[model samples]
Target: MTKQSSTDEQGDSQSGSARSWWLKGLALCGFLAAIGVGYYFFADQLSLKAIAEKESALQEYRQAHPVLVYVLAFGLYAMVTGLSLPGAVPLSLAYGWFFDLVPAIILVSFASTTGATIAFLVSRYLLRDIVKSKFGERLSTFEESLESEGPFYLFTLRLIPAVPFFVLNIVMGLTPIRVVTFWWVSQLGMLAGTIVYVYAGHTVPSITELAEQGASGILSRQLIIAFIVLGTFPLVVKYAMKRWKGTDARN
Candidate 1:
């Protein structure tokens, strides 16, 4: 009955595999459903005007319940970033408006990195296997480079705003990079941009102040230029590094 036992074991293995696939599928579907619900319920509330109003209330609440407000803000920022939503910029700006510069920077930096890590993990859990299997040959080069230069590549992407932050988090998850490396590199790479945005938020006045100044348009334009320069800094550095290496080789 050895042959019969072997056949039974094979059948059980197949059954287990099928069960695992079904579970993964169900989990993915649940995640998608949650995202849909979250977007539908919160999208309107996350608009700039809405956030500005919320900031006023948050400031008032912070007087008596500073700890609670801080926790809530952190959780909200993490959720927005983790879900690949669109309010991170506004939220960062709000943080600057609501809190001191140093604290705002610290909170935004850690919250963003934490949220990004969560998204990365989710992408790996849901799509990495499928993506790797389908594009194994084509992805071999990327995987190899990632193994050797993963942090540098990730840092470059984080510094350059050529790709959306959320997209980067998800895409990188499909690679073989270490999660810890991803977290630290992302934190450092995003620091400059975060500083620029937070500084703008901290300094830029509300609608009432803008109305009083009548130069809001000019100020806003200048800030946009500053952001562009900061965003392009990574490209400049990359080019400079290449040229320096070439000169060294020639020497």
Candidate 2:
């Protein structure tokens, strides 16, 4: 009777495990489908050229349906970022053009961060285990380093405009960092860059001029200051961390 009971327990456990895997598979499939649909329908519409072409109509619509436009804009921005697709740059600029600096900043900052968090969660849910299985030994050092100073590294990457944020979001998700930590760090880390981009979008006379100028035209004093901060941030953080560690060790 005990052996029979044990066998039944094993079967139940297996069934439960299978059901869990089945749910995960379904979720992944749904996520991919959403990406496919989004890319198919909205990818081209997300570009600067598209925004330029529809600039007048977009402006008129935004003026007429300000609240609705704001809600849709936020949703679209979050969806695009969450999918880890291209065009966040154009979207940021578009928002800047559509709204005032403060509003644009508020919208872009929260929306981008929300989207990033979604991507991060998706990567973690779907890919982290696979990554660990395939590259655990190789990534051990990296994982350890990230565990120790993940926020700082994440912040540094976020501060630099050259580093691609989508890639950063996905890679960091594979680490052992907590979800809350990822969200907050991303929110704060990406703020400076968001402000710069949104402000540029707001200040540009036309999206066509922005496209033609190719981001170089947006290199105003604010951008320069941002660049300077980006340059020095890593070094300063590294020194401070080292000093703190030394003090802790002495204590």
Per TM-score, the best of the predicted structures is 2
Among the numbered candidates, top lDDT falls to: 2
Identify the runs in model 1 with alpha carbons over 4 angstroms from their true place: 129-149, 207-229, 243-251
Model 2 spans with C-alpha error above 4 angstroms: 130-141, 161-163, 244-251
Pairs of colliding residues, candidate 2: none
Q: What is the C-alpha RMSD of each candidate to the true structure, in Å?
A: 3.8, 2.4
Q: Backbone clash tally for model 2?
A: 0
Per-residue lDDT over 159-244 for candidate 2, one digit per residue giving the tens place of the 0 to 100 score: 76444787677766787889998888889888877887787788888888887787897778877887677677767888999999
- lDDT per residue, candidate 1, 1-251, as tens digits? 69999999999999999998898899888877877887998888776677655556666789989888778888888888988877898778768767889999999999999999988998888867765676566456656767765577778878877668876787778887889988999999999888877777788666234324433532576688887888788888878877998899999
lDDT of 1 at 208: 34
lDDT (CA) per prediction: 0.79, 0.84
Looking at candidate 1, what is the lDDT of residue 80?
89
